[model samples]
Target: LLGRFFEARAKGRASQAITRLLELGAKQARLLRQGTQVMVDPLELVPGDTVIILPGEKIPADGVIDAGATSIDQSMLTGESHAVDRGPGDEVYAGTVNQQGRLEVKVTGVGPNTALARIARLVEEAQATKAPVQGLADRISAVFVPVVIVISLGVLATWWIATGDFADSLSNAVAVLIIACPCALGLATPTAIMVGSGRGAELGVLFKGADVFERAKEIDTVVFDKTGTLTRGAMTLTGLDSEADERLFLARVASLEAGSEHPVGKAVALGAEERDIELAPVAGFQAWRGLGATGIVDGVEVAAGRARFMADRGLHIPDRYLEALETFERRGHTAFLAGWGGEVRGTLAVADTMRESAPAAVAELRRIGIETAMITGDSRQTAEVIAAQAGIATVLAEVLPEGKATELARLDAAGRSVAFVGDGINDAPALAAADLGMAVGSGTDVAKEAGDVVLMSGDPMSAVVALRLARATFRTIKENLFWAFAYNTAAIPLAALGFLDPMIAAGAMAISSLSVVTNSLRLRRFH
Candidate 1:
């Protein structure tokens, strides 16, 4: 009976030890994984191949949509819940998803500069790029392990040489080494960054890495891209003539523009769809690119294009409608008037309108004391119009595609920490040049690759949320630094004076690192 009891006790101890070993292995594995290691190889992706994506699956790389129209749920890359419709020529980001459609996309970016590659680069860069000032914790950790080793050796040697206490010295040395781990110090940064990045991802904000997070905290000025950044980027039918049976005129115009690829044509078609109008097929179809289209509708030669198109046809477009057209054009709208047999019938106003959230987002930034500015290729009048609507005080209009980088440099030279928010092919150079570059959802992969942070919602308003998260993260870093530095300052002197044992110093080091990690974990609770 005694033998059986002893055997059972031994088995229990063995099981407990095995469990502990497994747990320790898991912890180490997790630490290694979070240690800023790159896992995916760039060469794994093939160029010019069709990348297939199913519903709810993240796009593994950057690609151009080759076929199929689907509602993409890009909330993982863009914070909005509205499933955006995508077709051929549209670029999809690496981490976005096909919400309800199966898209066969042609891989465009295959190597390090691909959207996914950019994401990886951003994350690594953020981690490697430390804040301007080192945290107190990291400085302490720098000297911590070495000092602990020296003091432990001295304690062991002094005890054995002075009192011949070999066992006592060993015990004291082991205790000191065991307790003085810099686990808290190490945890401080990775934990906070992981938490912040993860939370931002959930909210549709992708922080490339730590540097962006750190720099974002210090941003005093925000520059916006006009078209897709602040606006809906979709043309809408703002107004129409109701006095002349505008329904028939709109339907006739829609029929004329049915095959045209101009943005204004598409907007007219969408407006007609909303009104549930069935447009009759038109004949003698002709397109005047950059102007409009014309056709024979209901036996009448109906032409829908710029006011000049009507005037050229000898149609006397009334001064009243012309004035309205001028006003809409000044506000960044494209005006189209419809006419039959050279007599002006009606006018349709179309414009890419600003988002409902834009003005409110600007107000929120103002509330936080961040100055807002606008940068665009739009004419001065149009830029001023949008600026006024959004309550922005500074406006830089008529900026060409390549001019954005120069503007960013100018701002940098002026000593302002500028953050640029934009979407589109033209915004790539500026996105790369800004102190902090933000890419909105649905932009080109190149733009996403160039940005420090990608806003999945594609809404500029999310920039405000990002700024808040960054500030909070910076504060956590400061706290951790203080704890790390203070521990070394107090414990090192005590150890040198022979008052503090090696075991105590080790314990202090461990506590500092652990505390940093715990503080970082707290960021997970931030909304």
Candidate 2:
């Protein structure tokens, strides 16, 4: 507001003296420090602690719903609209308003574990860590401020001594100072980062800070997990090339495996449903967990499982069917052989297929110069098959959760900054170890919390969105640095020669600072 008044006065839109006095009053109000009435140290809140939140009171810590529900307004921190309904086990963050309902929350996280504290830490880290390229602006500003101040004084003194006109010298100094305010310099980098992060949030991507964001721009390689991350994590029937009523055999298998929890059982059941086949009732259902299931379906002993299960049951599967099963498995598919009594009837081929967006996303990444890779605990065939379909350039198969971090470290040692994208417990270590760890929104809180970047949508396309945001942010930083340095460089010399005025100096400072802030907000449009 003061900046506006000064700006108005400068342009003769408003009278100068009155506006200046009002501005000074506003400044006084801002700078006047008040003593605290009481010295009560704040309490550190923890998760699962029963917390009583009162009207107009700030939440002391992060907690979950333990008993009572509450209508919380978290607009301040998360920019959410309306009061949020929080019940038992739901996470409520600190600094959120309890607009309605009395809350009795079980504190789950206390002190530094609180979301507010985490945000604070992230903000602190953001402020502390400087991107290698962003430091240039700060270096210039450090030298610029003092030099400008000294030059203004020298200019005023020189003019007064030469012309014996104190008032004219003062006017010249005011002009120099006003024109030279370092507003642009101060506005540059931070504004770009703010804009970048804000834009990312709109696209369902949240960057922890500027440094994390900058690393995204430097990544030349990316690694992916196969199941859940690439495929649907659930198998479905692809094609059925068989004889002797395939649907009838599928329905029988579905009934036999209905009580089983194996992926094959579930796949068979789902296939029957998709084909609208009436299920056969099975008596004496028994499961073999990792193997298969057996039951008396339609008064005949039926079995569906691997070839081993069929062979053990004295069933004879034709060589043609066996070859087909082998071919499917080689291409990363799980095939179940179904038979009745002692003869193989049909084959149910199931596999976790790739998402429609995966291929396009991989292509886009390659177009942008990022090399794509996949890491998975799946069999070598499965991993290679998925990688080939997604157009990934590299593949790591049969990688257990413990081995992911080691692979990321190897990539780092090879001069590549690794970004591990995953959404499961297996991803936690890799997320932590990678230069940039990104979690899909569907992942566990621990994984999301561990990641430097989290995509609100689990879409593989979100990776592309994140990368775009990183590039934009990096560009904005460069723009900001340029403007900031330019402001300081131009202002100092004028101020040193009695060519700047005090009021002008103040106005210039206000403008420069405000410009930086405005520039920072530009990232909001990125979404």
* Top lDDT prediction, candidate number: 1
Backbone atom clashes (below 3 Å) for every candidate: 26, 38
How well is each residue in 61-178 modelled by candidate 1, as lDDT tens digits? 6678887778776554455777788888898766556677777777666545555444434443454545544465467668878988988788778767877878866766665555
Model 1 regions lying over 4 Å from their true place: 1-77, 81-180, 237-326, 329-349, 443-448, 493-508
In order of appearance, the predictions have TM-scores of 0.62, 0.60
Worst 10 residues of 2 by lDDT: 24-33
Question: Cα deviation of 67 in candidate 1 (Å)?
Answer: 12
Encode model 2's per-residue lDDT on 212-293: one tens digit a residue. 8678988888787766666766777775646877777777888887777655577778888988988877798876533566
Model 2 per-residue lDDT at 102: 61
Query: What Cα-based lDDT does every candidate model obtain?
Result: 0.68, 0.66
The TM-score leader among the candidates is 1
lDDT of 2 at 294: 80
